[model samples]
Target: MALEHAILVSLLEQPGSGYELARRFERSIGRFWTATHQQIYRVLKRMEADGWVVGRDVGQDGRPDKRSYEVSAAGRETLTEWLREPVQPEAVRHDLAVKIRGAAFDDAAGRARLVDEVRRYRAGHEETLARYLAGERRDFPAGGDLDTGQRLQHVVLRGGIAYERMLLDWLDDVLETLLKGLP
Candidate 1:
């Protein structure tokens, strides 16, 4: 999916300045779609030019005025059309998976390197899983009080948590097989 759609969804959730949107991407949206601050700004400009989003300048007491953006009617239409399109499964592009297979040709030292890398990767996933769990606890403390959007967002976060756990488990399996010299 394009970054545009992600931005639209985020704005719909709550209209905010470019800076605010970037922070949201860093905190929540980054789990599913990642874009740098520069990218976000660039897209916002394009989206505004296309008349898909409208921006308003808001004055601040101690800072420069920030332009807050919201979805225009055209933007909502575009988003709805995109939603109706079928989503294809994402293509896998895992460099570590390729490296794991390449380890078959490496000597003892290279194998050791692979093990270390696997451990590092697993550590990252563990951290992400922890973050997802914390977010779930903080955001959804009560089960029945959530609105439809909140419930959907929580479910997506749960999917992310599950995916990270699955990757961690698979990495453990890979580490065991590699260390044991199993074919």
Candidate 2:
């Protein structure tokens, strides 16, 4: 998906200034698609020019006015069209998988180094899993009256949680393999 699409979805969720939108991307949307602050601002400009988004100046006390953007009717149409398109399978490019395969060509010492790398990688995944679980608890609490959008968002978050859990399990297997036959 293009950055415009991501921006459209974000704006639909809630209208916000560029800075606010960038922060949302860093916090929640970053889990799926990442965008730098500058990139977001640039896209917002293009989207506004395309008449897909409307921006208005929001004044603040003791601060500069910020341009808040919201989806225009054209933007909703564009998003709907895009949403109806067939989704192609995403290409996977895993550096760690490549490195693990490359280990077969390396010396025992090199393999030993890779083992430590795997351990460190495992630690990072563990932390990510913990964070996902915490977010699930906080954002998607057990017995709440959720509207359709909230329910959909919770499902997506659940998918992220599941993905992280799977990654942690695979990383554990990688660690075990890396440790085997090591002197």
Candidate 3:
């Protein structure tokens, strides 16, 4: 999906300045769709030029005037259209997998180091996922009546949890294989 679509979807959630949108992406969308602050701002500008979103200047005391962007009707239509389209399988580009594949050429010590790195990475990701879950549970209680926005946020959170779990499982399998001396 184009970064523009992600920006438009974010704007649809609520009107926000570029800075606010960047924060939102880091907190929520960044789990699945990674984008830099510069990329987000650039996409926001392009989205405005394309008539997918409208920006209004809001001046606050002492701070610089912020341009808040909201998704336009056209943007909503575009998002809906994209959602209905079939998804293609995403290409895999895992660095750890590449390292594991190349471990055959290395001596035993080098292979052991690569396995250690993978273990560290897995532990870090697991901790991050735990944090994400804790925050979600705190923000939205299970039995609460969630509005559309809350529901959407929950869906994204679910995706993050599943992805993290898959990564953890993959890491375990890789660790087992490496320990067994199978290239």
Candidate 4:
């Protein structure tokens, strides 16, 4: 999906300034779709020019005015049309998986290097899993009432948590197998 679609979904959830939207991407939307602050601002401008989004300048007491954006009717229609399109299964592109297979031709030292790399990769996933869990706790606390949008967001976060966990488990297996081959 294009970055425009992601931005549209986010704005539909809540209208906000470009800075606020970038922060939201860092906190939440970045999990699935990532975009830089520049990208967000650039897209907002294009979306505004296309009549897909409307922006208004809001003046702050101390700071310069910031333009807040909300989806226009055309944007809503675009999003709906995109949603109705059939989704294709995502293609998997795993460099580590390829490296693991190629390691079969390497000597013990090369395999050891791969083992180290696997450990580092696994550590990254472990950190991500921990972060996802912490976010779930903070955002969807037990016994707390959630609005419809929040509930939907929580479910998506849960999916991300599950994905991270699955990656961690698989990485563990990869590390274990690699360790067996090392001296």
What TM-score should be assigned to candidate 3? 0.88
TM-score of candidate 1 to 2 decimals:
0.93
lDDT of 3: 0.85
* Model 2 lDDT per residue over 1-183, tens place: 478998999999999999998999887888788899999999899999999999999899999999999999999999999999898687687899999999989988999999889889888878877887898888778997899999988888888888888888898888788778585
Model 4 clash count equals 0
RMSD to the true structure for each prediction, in A, is 1.8, 1.6, 2.3, 2.0
Clashing pairs in 4: none
| Cα RMSD of predicted structure 4 | 2.0
Per-residue error (Å), model 4, residue 11: 1.2
Point to the candidate with the largest TM-score: 1
> What's the TM-score of every candidate structure?
0.93, 0.92, 0.88, 0.88
> Among all windows of ten consecutive residues in candidate 2, which has the lowest summed lDDT?
174-183
Off by over 4 Å in 4: 61-65
Whole-model lDDT values for every prediction: 0.92, 0.89, 0.85, 0.91
- Candidate 3 structure quality by residue, lDDT tens digits, 1-183: 567777877787778998998897787777767788898888888888988899999999999999999998998998999889888687677887789899989988998898889989999999988988897789788898998888888887888888899999989999999889945
Model 4 C-alpha lDDT per residue in residues 128-162, reported as the tens digit of each score: 88898998898899999999999999999999998
Name the top lDDT candidate.
Answer: 1
Off by over 4 Å in 3: none
Q: Which digits, one per residue and each the tens of the lDDT, describe model 1 over residues 108-161? A: 789998899899989988998999999899989965598899989999998999
